[model samples]
Target: MKIDAHQHFWALARGDYGWLTPELPPLYRDFLPADLAPVLRVNGVEGTVLVQAAPTIAETEFMLGLADDNPFILGVVGWVDFEAPDAIGQITRLATHPKFVGLRPMIQDISDVDWMLSKTHTPIFRAMATSELAFDALVLPKHLPNLQELVRDHPDLSIVIDHAAKPEIAAGQFNEWAANMVSLAQNTSVAVKLSGLVTEAAKDWTVSQLRPYVEHLLDHFGPTRMIWGSDWPVCTLACAYDDWCAATDQILKDLNETDRDAILGGNAARIYRIKGAA
Candidate 1:
């Protein structure tokens, strides 16, 4: 099965997407399943993991509701108040929904770089571990060290790094990001999504500018721990869906069928526990 492991669905009227405003014309409006289904079809993608674009539980419920109606949505990585006093109860409740496969705290938006490692959040991590839910780290390179610590502390937590830590490819620098990525990959339990790179690079970015980072990830995480994601509407900011799909294909052209399949879909299926994805 071909899966777009990460993508988002949001309604502009929801009033919860703080980062998505008219300022960003491409993604300022609604992007629902109707808008994406054709793109997925044309790209030969069978299913997708709908990730949260808003931090509110309302958005999570909204995505889950959409998933209930959309068979192509294999799973959802929603958000919850991880630091809330009733976080365990919240996680337990969310886990009852079979489609709620993972949780994502927008760590990148949080000012405290060490927020992921706060002692108060440990119980929440434990609850996630107990629920067998994956945690999508929405982080930047600076947050990686703390992320490594979190992975080490919660070895049972299935963690996937979103957007390959959002490398500064546009600035043409990789030493710091690559070093942290290599270090983080030491924990076999952690995986990464090869998504959002096009938006991070120069507007006219070439595959050559991305090849080094992609190769670094392939070398360190290997295909088993790597997953592909379109980042969808956000990706449209830099390029179209088919364009990103073609770029990803070119990036993985050197890999044999087995490995390529894993990065493209298999790894996400295993990590997110997406039903019937194989």
Candidate 2:
């Protein structure tokens, strides 16, 4: 099954996905299952993991409610206040939900890019060890060093690097991004997501413009550590869902079947510990 491991859901009326308004003009409107299903069908995606876009427990509950009705949504990487004094209880509460597969903190929103390396967050991460939950680093390249340090301390934590460190491909800044990417991927516990490259490139970019970034991730992380993600409506900023999928397909056309399968779905299933698909 082809699994798009990174996608999102939001209700504008809920007023939770606020960061999207300024950075994601194309997707400022509500992006429900109704809006995402067609794109999935067009791209032949069989299932997806609904990731968090806001920092609210209600957002997690809301995604759980949606997952109940949508079979395509196989898992959810929802949000919760990890640093709360009662974080252990909160993690226990969230663990009861079958769809709750992981968590995200939106590290890019934090002022201190190195917060992941702090001792304060270690306990919160340790709390997640109760259920062995994976954590997505929603961060930029600047935070990669901190992430590397975090992996050293929490060897069991499955940290996925979202958006390949969000390269500055639109401006052709590949060398720096590549250096950080390689450094982060060196941590065996960490995995990389091959998504959001189109948004990092120029609006009128061709498939070739994104190949270097895609190939770099595959080369550095390899198939076992690389997973596919659609990034959904945010991807609409540079290209539609179908366009991004097509570009990715073209770029990997030369790879062997095993590697292709890994990037498309196998890696995601194994890394997220999702049942059946792995």
Candidate 3:
């Protein structure tokens, strides 16, 4: 099954997403499964891993509710109260629902880049590893060094870097981001999502500008460690969903069919522990 490993579904009126204000007109509205199913069909994608859009347990519950109804949603990566005293208990409860696949701590939004590396989260990390959950790192380039440490301390944890650490492609910030990612790939088994590149590039971004960055990631992570995502309505801020699917095809055109399949869906199923992976 072809899986879009990273995407989001949010209702603006939920009032949980603080970053999502009226200023961003395109994404200010609701993006539900009904809106995405046809897009997935047109792109030949079978299912998707729905990720958290807001930093609240409420949002996670909402996504889980959606997953309960939408069989096409392979897994749901939701948020949890890391600071809560009973965070582990929360994981235990959430894991009871088979479709709750992972948790994403919005590292990029936190003021302290070192928040994830805190000693406080050690048990939380342990619980996630015990529960067999994936850690979706929503981080920035500056957080790469600490993220590497995060991977090291919890070697058993299945971690995937979101948006290639949101490289500053529009600002042409490549060298540092590339070097950091290369080090992460070299030292740890962390996976990465091949999504959100369109938003990072110029509004009139061309395939040429994206080639070098995407090539670097593919070379370092290889298809086995790289997963595909749409970032969807958020991606719509940059280009249409069909455009991203087309661009990804053009970029991976040289890869063998097996490698292409791995990045597209095979790896996601294996990483997220979804059924029918092979």
Candidate 4:
């Protein structure tokens, strides 16, 4: 099954998407499953992992509601108040729903670079590990060290690094980012997502420009540890769903079918524990 492992659906009226402003013309409006169905169909993507766009638990519930209605939505990576004293309780409740596969802390948006290392959050991580839930690291290059520390602290947590830590492709520099990624991958338990790169590059980015970073990820993480994601609607900011899909295909064309299958869908299924697909 071909699955787009990382994507988002949001409603503007929810009013929790503080970062999604009217200034961003393409994504300022609502993006629902109906809007994405045709795109996924045309791209030959059988299912998707709907991710959180807002940090509120309300938004997570909203996505869960959508997933309940859409079989195409295989699972959800939603948000929770991880820093709250009652975070374990929240996680326990959310995990009852089979579709609640993971949680993301939006580490990149938080001002404190060392926020992940806080002692208060350690129990939350422990709870997540106990629940067998995945942790999506929505981070930037600078936060990678803290991420490394996080992996060390919670070695068994199913952590996936979103956007390859959102590399500096737009500026054509990835020395530090690459080094950090290499360090993190040494954990062997961590996984990386091949998504959101186009939006990080120049508006008219070519496949060649993205090749080095993509190749770097494949080389460092290997096909088994890497998963593909569309990062849709947000991807529409720089390229269409088809454009990103085509670009990903071109980049992975050199691989044999087994490796290609693993990167595109197999890894996501195994990592997220997404169900009901043959």
Report the Cα RMSD per candidate. 0.8, 1.5, 0.9, 0.8
Task: Give the TM-score comparing model 1 with the true structure, all chains together.
Answer: 0.98
Q: On residues 121-226, what C-alpha lDDT tens digit does candidate 4 reach at each position?
A: 9889888888889999999999988888889989889999999899989898889999999999884689999999998999889999999999988888999999
lDDT tens readout by residue for model 2, 1-278: 89999998898999877686656566777889998898888888989999998999889999999999998998899887867888778888888888788989988998977777777888889877668788888888778777777877888787888888898887888887788778877747689898988888888999888888888888888888988998987788788888888888999999999999989998888888787675
Candidate 2 deviant stretches above 4 angstroms: 22-25
lDDT of 3: 0.92
- Model 3 residue 278 distance off true place after TM-score fit, in angstroms: 4.3
233 in model 3: Cα distance from truth in Å? 0.9
Sequence-dependent TM-score of model 2 = 0.95
Q: In terms of TM-score, which candidate is stronger, 2 or 3?
A: 3
Q: Each model's C-alpha lDDT?
A: 0.92, 0.85, 0.92, 0.91
lDDT of 3 by residue, 57-148 (tens): 99999999999899899999998889999999999999988899999988898999799989999999999999999999999999999988
Q: Which 10 consecutive positions of candidate 2 have the poorest summed lDDT?
A: 17-26
lDDT (tens digit, per residue) of candidate 1 on 123-164: 898888889899999999889888888888999999999999
Any idea what lDDT model 4 has?
A: 0.91
User: Which portions of model 1 miss their true places by more than 4 Å?
Assistant: none
Q: Between candidates 2 and 4, name the one with more favorable lDDT.
A: 4
Show where candidate 3 strays beyond 4 Å.
Answer: none
Q: Candidate 3: which pairs clash? A: none
